[model samples]
Target chain A: MGNDALNVEHSSGHSAAVFRETQDSEQFRRLKRKHRGFVLPVTAACLLWYFTYVLLAGYAPDFMATPVFGRVNIGILLGLSQIVTTFAVTMIYVSYANKQLDPDAAAIRDRLETKEGVR
Target chain B: MLHLAVTAPAAPGDPVLNIAIFGLFVAITMVIVFRASRNNKTAADYYAAGRSFSGGQNGSAIAGDYLSAASFLGIVGAIAINGYDGFLYSIGFLVAWVVALLLVAELLRNTGKFTMADVLAFRLKQRPVRIAAAISTLVVCFFYLLAQMAGAGGLVALLLGINDRVGQSVVIAVVGALMILYVLVGGMKGTTWVQIIKAGLLIAGAGVMTIWVLAINGFNLSTLLDSAVETSGNPAILAPGLQYGLSDITRLDFLSLGLALVLGTAALPHVLMRFYTVPTAKEARKSVVWAIWLIGIFYLFTLVLGYGASALIGAERIAAAPGGANSAAPLLAFELGGSVLLGIISAIAFATILAVVAGLTITAAASFSHDIYASVVKKGNPAPGAEVKVARRTVVVIGIVAILGGIGANGQNVAFLVALAFAVAASANLPTIVYSLFWKNFTTQGALWSMYGGLASAIILISLSPVVSGGEKSMLQGVDFAVFPLSNPGIVSIPLAFFLGWLGSVLDKKKESLEKQTEMEVRSLTGVGAEKSVAH
Candidate 1:
């Protein structure tokens, strides 16, 4: 929506104006809210989990070293779990995006490009 | 440099066989690139393969590009010697991918074109942000390329038993020339295909070694772990004290390293650039999912490969090798499968470098052509077909520079070199992405400050921080002028980079910088008016 920069000679002023208009549009705001709704809490939780593992490894060596099985200890279990958690989070995000975020985003795009015929 | 540190210059592995395997892989990659270039018609063709890749294919290609010699060779070797500490890197690298996939990848794909600058300048003032981003991309790409080049030279020399500078330079030159050809001819399409082949070969090679390791330990993971701890002869390895647990300072260093690895992988320019190779934002997300699976499986296999090397080869022997732990995999190959297997693994390692440097060369060339030449110099009026020509020329310049840098860095501890790149990416590029995507208040001034400040601080810290100027292990040798305590700079520079960005935006109340925040937000989220797929 910001200035069609490829052809526009004075793109700065025009680009900023286009975005200011988009900023005021209700559909843009709703689309952003939906994206933020799903993304924020998930990212926050993942970071917290990641840091806890890293901090435990850094500061609580004893906790990390506590024996879970014979030679397999708590630290190694946690480390492997980190890999497992990454896979789970990815699947969760992808499924959530497919079900919730993608449809609404596609709708917004269609409204812009086809309904309103905005370039 | 990392490989040379592990293995001494013993008689090289097998010149005739190594060369044969190396020649075969190189010749095939060249043919792929040569054929792909015939279809090249525009900047989009040169840069994003005309957005032709499906999610799964792009995913495989991303894995090929991301899994450089560092992950394939360095981390496995590091773990063989360092125990859980070595796999810590694997965790950091993987977790970072997850973070980027969930939060960043689609946005990058939906917003950016061929380079990081496209995304950064989406909302901010265009010229200044592009300039800052080009510099940051160049800095990150240069160091990463240098490390790959040096690693390739050392791996080849050690494998082929080449002892002198002449032999090593030949290795460096051949690699440089091949990579130049890939970028000049293949553009993104050829490079992506080469990366796919490399990823497949790497996975197969690593999978074989892991299976061999598991077979040796009777396929029981616990037994393998126990044997690893026992054979290591260092009880501390089973715990966390071997690599970074010695003292309080080292512990801080460990945390800093963790921060760098986790954030660094997300910010890597080449890795982010891969998202553009696919067309739709959905494909972008799928590409990341595919990368997670491939990278997840690959890293898990690396754990087995690492411990297997230790249990099978013994700690002292791995230490004694000229390349240190870097020789663990090849040595393990030879132990399990004899000379033929070792030769194959070495050849796979060479292919790994070729794919990685090709990816890096193109990314660097894009930063030069798209960011610097098209966006900055041409002032957004790039004529049709002009950008790709400049890109081809840029590839030659980068290839030559990398060859020289690699030759200069040969035989040094290139281990930490990649870490420095990660730190720069984390400190500089990550902030730029986060701010541009999330921060409504982010201005052009803030973007520039963050990019340059993070880049400069990372380089300065790394140069002074024992990696370059410390003791015998340091590149500077006997004279120790290293004042920076930790080798990794993430704990300091990353926060500083973010802070500078926030402060600069707050200070520079440019009304225009705030105006496009919503437009960038909408477009990045919903892909309105994003570059449509160019029909083939």
Candidate 2:
């Protein structure tokens, strides 16, 4: 998969010639481009949420200390917030990758299958 | 009508509730250990969970091992007594997880098999490097184990009403026995499960305490602050600086401790080894994310427990106890939640010590058997099952040594001992690990120099610091020692380690073809290169 992506870049300028001579396909290029965005953003968002939680605890002690229930301090709320954040980030990433990135990567993968079939 | 104060005499009883709670905890642990033993077959199974844990499970175990007695109890106690300064350790510890997530977790998981020395000596062809790393690993683990054992003793004494020495001895014997079982029977599988279960119970208990604390404070920010301020004589309970006796310098020292905790957690031999229990690098990453949530929540509860201790139990009581501020959380449980809750909390504390110490013992054993004995002395090949037997034997020796250390250090402040361990770890181990991972020119010579330099410098600085030097019984009590101002050595040692590592790497760049070796090393570490090359 990585080899195909690298080859696509190397053959971009000679797309017409390469497409004719080699089993280079349009679907594979699009798929590789699509999946590239999935991992980086998901990782970044998770880290961001984590740091934000830390910063909030460090800076917003008063707001965090505000008890929502009898004796339930704000720190508990902030701490529990990480659970929500983790789930939220993870769910969003999985959904986004499934909906957006994986299909594209799969399409490119299918193109390889068809190319191999032709050969 | 004025009610005159009547002094109540100290009440003495059989502490039946405490005994029952402790007995139940032991029974449960034994069941788990015995069950784990059923699955123990190969040495790999004993040492690395047969390398089968998912990222999340290992992550929890990491959290379990990482959240020590000091973290679970001492931080809360410190916060209760010293206010925001005390909470700094939690923040530091949490940030260190971020370090683990980003840099060390996956890398170490990918590089090492059982011990950290395996990773350190992967590229370097030096017996001295492996020996040095093993020694450092043992030293750090022993100090950490001593702190945990002492904590266990304190917990037992507090709950069972036994004399401190008896409590210490019992904890030593029980933990030693349990750890030996963990190694001989379940191995990594048993240890990992113990850590996971303990982490769960610990967080759940802390969560319960947090809810209780908030409920007692009426869930009112203003009211909570007002009460804390009124009781504490410092209205700045809501703000960072509103607390007393906390100056800028002290705050920075607290921050240094925090940095040490976070970074130190990643460097800890036991905690780092937990990552290797998983099969793949991706799982290792996933487990860390899980650990982040567990650790973050536990630390958050610690903040509440700290404030709760001050607001409800009063700082005076916390200070008056034999353990001083460190006893605040346990004491608060006793006062607020009654004996039942106290019993549970104390049992959980005991479990915390046992789980952490068991992890430490296993790591120390691995270092001794795998790194020093098998790899260094025997040149990496030994008779079948011999290494495993040696590891089990080493566990007994290490456990005994830890007990003696715990006994010698009993009645001393645990927070100081833990902090010293962190300082030493941050100084000695972290630099070597980070340099080896990232720096291309990190030769065996560089690793050797950095490890010894950081170790020696941290020891000297700590000996000269106020924590040891200014004490009445200190060797340097009457002598003038110009160590750094802060009692903790993180600020000095961390930077010093980095400098030594960098300097050594730079000087040795010409001695070897570092770039070529580092390229191959990175490929192996990342699992990006060919598999056949990796086997070599």
Candidate 3:
């Protein structure tokens, strides 16, 4: 099995071998766990915001239209807020993921490459 | 249902001005179509722009395809008449992309080669799952395509002063022909560029219109509100309609509609396919971020148009027009910018329909060719070039089906059909896709059960809804009650699908373990599981 693995690795090239061998690695497990944390909260927040707009527009029409401006209603404000929420969520996610998640994943990747060199 | 009175008598033949405008649009589209053909090459080139689209370019095309006639025309008209409730739809659409970005985009890019069915059925024995996914894809795409075609026909009739049927058939034929040429000649590369350019122009036009609208209202949000309030005869411009305002029922309906819009985008086969155009999962993520920004800005402009329509043209005038509130934006443009700008705006609307319908057609073709024909029927032995050829042929077949569906359902009530499509998408596709990507225990049986269950339930409920059953007029109208209110099944069906998927997965755990070998299939898909299992 080990020889077969090496032969397949030789044929497909190093990157493929690394990708295959890392499937059950601690690094992959950690990345997947981190991704879950990020994705769940973000998705939940978006869904919550979406429902809030709809609920406010439907049930509290008067409150939504509480007249921020002359004729601009609360519905319009909430509706437009959807656009703001989209960008806010996106920017926050990108910055956080790049700063926190990517570096950790990168460190693991470097370790894997160095291990491959030792092998 | 409103018919134009045609206040002015017909002066002579062909309405020369209308002919000139229509002719010019056709001429330009043809030139662009042929020029785009120059980029077409292999099957990959046809389906995914040769996987060469930069994040920004694909993002623009995604925005273009996403902003259908519904967003550009329907939301504006809805806002013009319904005020705040109308803008709710735009907000729902914009926020939906968040789901696309965080949950579906990177996963879809990593999993599937071409079609969404490929992603869903990735770990499963492909045949049954592929067949079911393909059917759902075709059904959803067909319904959506019909709505686009009908919108095209209506837009032409509204703009050119022609018989509605004649206008519709012309649009059907023209769009069908162009879509076929787009797939057969231009492929994905051409399609992407066309989508990108169209999206850019559409956004620019919306921005221009928004600025003009605010300028007309002197950029005073309060004054604009006062004018809208005065014009609308409602104290608040955002209040609910004559029928639905100040009611719990209406509020629930609004929330359901929003849920459908936000969740449905992640599930849409065509929209999901666009993420694959980017090279890596990282680029896929970046493209979605860009798409969110572009779509957000464009929707904000929609709010301006909605308010602008009421302030400038009067809601009553819009309500009285042939298509009722839907014509508000175009009419407002005519009043604000005169005939030339009206012509330009109208032309852009027409272009919007073509570009969207074309994207839908290509996605549908890929689903049929890749999922059903190659994967399921042929057991993945598609002889390399055979799959692409099959895909091109499917484009023509699907295009014809869409044209026919449009004609059959032409005047029957298109708005209702479109809402139903969104409902079905949110219910059937969203749950299955999300579970597959995120849930490790999601079994083939669970996916199959949830997808078919969601698809069947939404379709049945919609068919029995007041919108389709004609309210009080039909024989079963009194007895056959709508399972869900708001005529859209997203609220009920989406949750139902998720529950079913969870139940199926939980109950079938022992059987699921029998297929533990499938965990290795994930590596084949994400390039992670394959190496460990395949000795490579």
Ranking by lDDT: 1, 3, 2
Which residue ranges in model 1 land beyond 4 Å of their true spot? A1-28, B1-13, B513-515
Candidate 3: residue B32 lDDT (0-100): 70
* Per-candidate DockQ vs. reference: 0.53, 0.07, 0.35
Which runs in model 3 stand beyond 4 Å of their true positions? A1-24, A72-74, A103-119, B1-36, B240-247, B472-485, B509-536
In the range B1-536, model 2's lDDT, one tens digit per residue, is 00111231121223677667867977887788788667666556667877788877887898888888777777787777766545645666775665566557666765566777766765665477789888888878877887777666555555565554665577667766766666566678888888888898889988998888888777654455456656788644544433322455554565556556655766888878887788765577778788887887788788778888888877777766645565677787887778888777877777788788888888999889987787767666667778888988888888778777776665555446677777777778888887776666777777877888877877787777766666544434467574666666787778888888788777775464443344324322333221111110
Model 3 per-residue lDDT tens digits across residues B228-289: 77787776555654334646666566566667777887888888888777776667778899
Best by TM-score: 1
Candidate 3 residue-wise lDDT at B441: 81
Identify the leading candidate in terms of DockQ.
Answer: 1
lDDT of 2 at B471: 54
Please state the CAPRI-style docking class of candidate 3: acceptable
The C-alpha TM-scores of every prediction are: 0.95, 0.79, 0.89
| Interface root-mean-square deviation (Å) of every model | 2.8, 11.0, 6.7
Candidate 2, A5-69: lDDT as tens digits: 21122222322232332223444334334433554355455556655654555556567667666
Error of 1 at B225 (Å): 1.1
**What is candidate 3's CA lDDT for residue B49?**
67
lDDT of 1 by residue, B304-366 (tens): 988888888887787677566778888888888888888888888888898999998899899
Worst 10 residues of 1 chain B by lDDT: B3-12
